[model samples]
Target chain A: MNEDKKIGILDEKTYSNQIHLIGRVGSALLLMFMLGIPFVIGTVYDCMPKFSWLIQPSIALLAMMGPTSVSEVLGYAPVLGSGNYIAFITGNIMNLKLPAAISAHALAGVQPNTPEGDAVGTMAIAISSIITVIICAIGVLVFIPMQPILTSAAFKTASNYLVHALMGSMILNTFGKGKGKTVIKNKLMLPLVAIAMSVAGVLLIPKFSSYQGYAMLVAIVITIGWAYLLYKKGVVKVVNRDEK
Target chain B: MSYLDIANSGLTYTLVAVALSVMLGLCVVFYVKTRKRALELGISKEVLNKVNRSTILFTIVPSLTIVVGLFAMSAMIGTAWSWFRLSVVGSVSYELMAAQTTVASLDIADTATADGSVFVAVMFVMSIGALVGPTLSAILTKPVTQNLQKAGAQNNGFSPIMNACFMLAIMSVIIPIRVSTGGLVGLMVILTAVLLSMLIDKIASKGVAWLGQFNMPICLLVGMLSSLVWAKLLG
Candidate 1:
């Protein structure tokens, strides 16, 4: 029964959607515009300054491109496409005085899987870009020059924890969902697996002691095993049973 | 032009940008609402199969409206308008900034104030956004429920590969599109969030049940507001 179920789940019928035709073309066009305008403007602004008036229009055009009909765009797609631009710009606007990676970390939280926890988490990345930039700018430009001692005291590694804060939020979100069982199981056993494989490799290859292939081999095995188990147990079973 | 005229043009450009986004967004909301209604009302299987198509329409409609609106505004405003012409002015300003810095550098031999320093700064910031957004999207997209609580464990048959691949494709398309010529910054940020969500299938995930797929207007509104501020202050 399990075998049969797995086969059914792997089939293509499960991928069928309910979206309409007009919706498809419309969504594509909107996505193009939303994605296209800012890139053009930013690239132009960054590359050529002769056409400065295009900056605001470029921003306005990009802002208006958010997902409307499909809930898909804002949930995950933006993190990759539009969110990157936001982060990049946020970092740019701050003049890179702020750690640029923080923006990506923040937007990662807006992913749709987490329980609606706090508005801060929702807006943390977006807010952080502005806040960090302002804080850093003041510290670097005004405070440092005016009160070197005080500004130096304020400068600490703690300020850079924006990325960590965002990551913690993501970890918390994943844990809250209770769906990371597979990940947890793998993480727990992987240490033992790693040790065993390392010892075996040393014993089998006398001259290969310097080789790291053993570790790579172990990782491959574990990944393949996990994927197979997930496919057979989760994916296949779900698809086949639903068809019934 | 008089100060009042300049003020009016700026304000008008800002409003028009917002209006376009809101109108486009509203159309999408309505389209989704109607589609949901159809689903609830028991649309035929054949019709249901086309629901995705309808959803696509909501996005396309708003997109077209935005493009047309931009062209119309640009033509009406004239070549010297600053609102929608970020590329043209920023380049010139930065070049001026570079030239000024170069002269200063030549006078003092200070590399920190040179053009090279500015390039590094901008690139560094852009990289940060690229890394964080995708990671966040991936983390947020983890499923809430794994095995069903019923008799036997039944999977949703969700394809992580498909999800990841689809997201990558969506992101790939969106990144270039927003950053391309004539693109706006506000729309880009909002769309980034949207694209992140879509890539991770966050909309379909239970935790963030309210996530939407395509929303150009909200992004545009927020982005425009910020851009306007950026322009007024930084311009």
Candidate 2:
């Protein structure tokens, strides 16, 4: 909201376009590399599987993954900004990259959609991606000595609970106010979340657990629509802290 | 060759190394791009550095799940492939699902019987299936991010509220599935995290400057660790 602190208009699009190019090129390269691994095994190692074996499963998996890919990219892209490229490539969007980007912006006292927030998000995601690669490398290097601990019951339990833990902490940020300075007043906010969760608990999870990204995508659309309704109702007041 | 032989071979490790190197290179590229823009946007070096430090700390605990994924997939596939997949375009859920498809179809009881056919099936399926999200993301992210921000700026005062409501709504959907599937331990983890998060916010609000950086990490660790206690007592 600080005009003096924001990117000036002479080449205002400089940051967005530069990041777009980076994201585009980076994405294309990653795709090649990702697909290349399978090609390498097929050609060099001479270990191609029967095409027939893949026929049934490939269709099934694609049917599932296709929608998932669309939903995740569509849902996460707007929020992720320039960081989307690295985030999607590096994966762990829900569990790591998304939260990392959001928190980075919040902790730095930046807004969601500005150049500052986008840049900080990209940087935060990059830092996060690097750490995961290093950790996995370490995990690979020390697998023998670390086998028991990695496979332990306690470790499994904690890993299963990690996402919930992250979600719980992050949800607090939305309820009132933190970095964004603006908030959806709790009058409408409380009923909105409670009803949405009740619907999800009743309708989505039990039926579509395997298809969570898609289900989440649906929830997002409905939430946005409902928010729009609230917007029209004139009940969703968001007075900026500076203006106040 | 035996499945384990190919799965854990020297070449396999080398492939993973090369892939990992490429990912790291991309990360560096992204880091530099954003850092430059952040500076131009009048963000201070001190704040940027704080962002970096905070992000690194925030990432570590959540990355426990990634570590867990690596171990889980390594058992089904191999360490090198597991490492590679988890590093690039692979999630714990997606990788496991893909691997399980190969396992069930091939009836792969153990590493010994998982032949070249099984390995090939696994890799191809995992690689190809995992490509969807990132591939589309590559094509669509810029337009999406740019347009969304543009819309927000053009709109009058509603965008932030919409964003806040959306954030909360997304959490509403996620929390139930996660907690429901998680059973009692999930609820306990969330309760612990919420309390800790509130405490951090309260203290930070009271002018504890540096404490902000550790908020998410502290909450994540205690929340996750609390699961062990909940499971022990309740299970």
Candidate 3:
């Protein structure tokens, strides 16, 4: 019943094996680093918090982050692939890494969900991650001198708009016809579904921000489910869709 | 030692440096490996060059914005910790929230004078709590990506549609929430960005080769600039 029945892309060699091995191991190591930092600080200062104190904040953190973890993996995996490892590690997925990968693919005139696309995505992320680390280091070195420009009200206000602005421009790139052609025929279906879901979210969820993660998961299922349904119904046709 | 002193300690700085160096080193390895593979796949050198150029240009503003976050958060979390955290799954919002939660649980007034226990606890909460996403990604990304690839490999067009939907799913939730909460400036910023992106795309389609490559950053800048206009108008 799945329309995505495997076909012949015989010429293409799979690139997932090595990338996954590195990705999994690297992520595990990075997690250790994350934990290690605290442990080291605690040891040096001998100031580790009591176990009893952790219970309250852990619960609160779990409530917010649990859904987010699941949602991010589900939504981002399809686009990011092995790049997920570094992208997740680097931790600026929506704003920096994702846009970087997507933009790289777009510039190269490559299609997503393909081997070439995945490689380019990974490459872009690596480049961006490297750049980010370098920039952060530089920022730290100059933190004192740049304090005024960085903390200015105008700068702070503009910073608030960064995500909004970035996402808006990104919509056209992702949803609309930013490049030559896309696979979907009825391109509007998913976006409309997504918008409707958002409107419903706004009307229904009084505290939308706190529940954004849950809403995100719900939206993913609804929008993808809607797209799949339309695909099954033949309402959305695939064009230039060469699986090979 | 004082909170600031502990946060800025040489030990903290050294640990952060080593971790980041490892990460940076890994990026180099991955990039080199992926680059070789890309060439093997017959992607032209010229195109790869374009990707490099485009990526560097596109990344600057976003990365600097993160530093802006770093600047704000460093005051609270300290420079080294802020750098390490932002470079690894750390967001200003998450960092701020984690700090507040840690303080609240410890019954502290602020991060500056909080005990070493409080600082360490804040560190733990920040990392361990946010591990869900990256941890899941590490375990599940390969299989998920393979499945999507397999599905796309099938002659059917469902896979690409699936990919598009995933992005839509994310954008749907994130964009609306921002617009709704952002009020007038939020609304204007989003609208301006959408319009500007569309305009740029139109121009790119007309053969401005360089413009097409840099469209995202351009739209983002213009979009952020539009917020200032809205802010001034309202004032």
True contacts kept of each: 0.01, 0.70, 0.79
Expressed as tens digits, the lDDT of each residue in B1-235 for candidate 3 is: 6677788889889999999998888888888877877787778888888788778876877788888988778788788889998987878888888878877878887677766777777778888788888799988898888888877667667877776676677777888888787888878888888888778778876887667767777778888878888999973
Every candidate's lDDT? 0.29, 0.76, 0.79
Q: What would the TM-scores of all predictions be?
A: 0.27, 0.91, 0.91
What is chain B's TM-score across the candidates, in the order shown? 0.26, 0.90, 0.89
For residue B125, model 3's alpha carbon misses the true position, in angstroms, by 2.4
For every candidate structure, what is the RMSD over all alpha carbons to the true structure, in angstroms?
Answer: 18.0, 3.0, 3.8
lDDT of 1 by residue, B108-148 (tens): 34333333222222222222212322233222222211111
Compose the digit string of candidate 2's lDDT tens values, residues B95-173.
8888788667766677567667678678888877777887798788878777877776665767765555445555666
Candidate 1: misplaced stretches above 4 Å?
A: A1-163, A175-226, A229-244, B1-8, B11-235
How much is A16 displaced in model 3, in angstroms?
A: 0.5
Who is ahead in TM-score, 1 or 3? Answer: 3
Error of 1 at A39 (Å): 14
Clashing pairs in 3: A47-B117
Best DockQ among the predictions, by candidate number: 3
Per-prediction DockQ: 0.04, 0.65, 0.69
